[model samples]
Target: MTARTLVMLAVLAIAAGTGWLSRGWFEDAQRLTALEAAQAAASQALARESVIAGVVEARLATLDTHQRVIDRGVIREIQKPIYRRVCLEPDAVRLLNDAAAGRAPDPADAADPLPDDAAAVE
Candidate 1:
């Protein structure tokens, strides 16, 4: 081979080696981003679940107090408000509305007044 061919081959070999070594770096970066996203989702879910559980516990406690304690008509009995403050963002509201909205009640779902269209067509 000529000197030029040898130099070109050497350059190609070096580039291939560099690419092979760098491949792991790209894969590791991808894995790291995915892991971080998963962790964030997990943390958010945990916090949301904990808050819901606490609300349930508080409601239960309120009910229990109401049943167990016979309050004398003394105006001294302070009643704590046990209201659930649900603040949904626009996106959250849209999601909830979408989920709650069922498919429009099709006429077929009700008692069929007439022979089925499919049957008539057949």
Candidate 2:
């Protein structure tokens, strides 16, 4: 072979070796890009879930505040002078107890008259 052909072959061999060695570097760059994308997606998902949790916590806090207000109102109403002075008959007391216990009270019990002493106290 002529010197010119030998030099050309040498150049081709060097180029092929460089390309083969650089293939790993290219593959590593692609893998790094894919990992970065996956990490970004996971971060977005975590942020969305955190927002949902915050909303749920706020709703629960609102419900608790509303419940406290209702409880206070009920306490104030029960402490009124009229309610304090009132006395319930045995049948009426029984009906109230049954109602409070989530049972259906007898209609007949509701129609019973208050005692004479209970009426005088009112």
Candidate 3:
């Protein structure tokens, strides 16, 4: 073979070998880019979910505080002494019925006289 022809073949052979060796590097770079994009997407989704979880936690804390307040009020009411009426006065019964029906009790009901025994209980 001529010297020029052999040198041309050597250059071509080196070029081909370099291209073959670099193929794997190019493929690895593409895979790394795709993985980075996927990781970024997952990070954004996690941030949004964390925000939602914090809101839910705050709402639950508020609800728990309200329930505690209601429980304290209930305990206070239950601890108060309860007075039992030995007899239900007619006007008092009417007033209770009116209150239960969401109506204002008559002013006259307050002026009505109680039985003699009612004062003894007090």
Candidate 4:
């Protein structure tokens, strides 16, 4: 071929390769923009969840304080010592007398005076 024809062919080939390579660059930029959008959405969702959790925790604390005040008021009203007494009606006593003459009381009727943790140990 002639020198002019060879130079034109070389220029055309370089231009085609550059266009092919820049196509990938454009695709990569589009992918990056989509990823950034997703990350921003996730960050906003996390922030909203955190705010809701904080509000819920604050409300729970207020409820805890209110319950404590009511419990303290009730406990303060009880001044008598703990005691247990069992009295049966006439019909109930007759039934009990017929059932047994002498027998130990049922263990299930015993009052549990221990704290919850101490009872669990037994």
Candidate closest to the true structure, highest TM-score: 4
Error of 1 at 46 (Å): 0.5
- lDDT on C-alpha atoms for all candidate structures: 0.75, 0.82, 0.82, 0.75
User: Which portions of model 1 show Cα errors greater than 4 Å?
Assistant: 1-3, 65-122
Distance from true position, residue 23, model 1, in Å? 2.4
Could you give candidate 1's per-residue lDDT for residues 1-122 as a string of tens digits?
Answer: 99999999999999999998899899999999999999999999999999999999989888733346667785565555433224544454554565589534444434434555755753
The residue ranges of model 4 lying beyond 4 angstroms of the native Cα positions read 65-122
CA lDDT, candidate 4, residue 11: 100
Residue pairs in candidate 4 whose N, alpha carbon or C atoms collide under 3 angstroms = none
| Model 3, residue pairs in steric clash | none
Please estimate how well model 3 matches the true structure, expressed as its whole-model Cα lDDT. 0.82
Q: Rank the candidates by TM-score, best first.
A: 4, 1, 3, 2
- State in Å the error of residue 42, model 2: 0.5
How well does model 1 score by local distance difference test? 0.75
lDDT of 3 by residue, 1-122 (tens): 99999999999999999998899899999999999999999999999999999999989888733333334444444442234553776677788899899999766657756677977955
Stretches > 4 Å off in candidate 3: 65-122
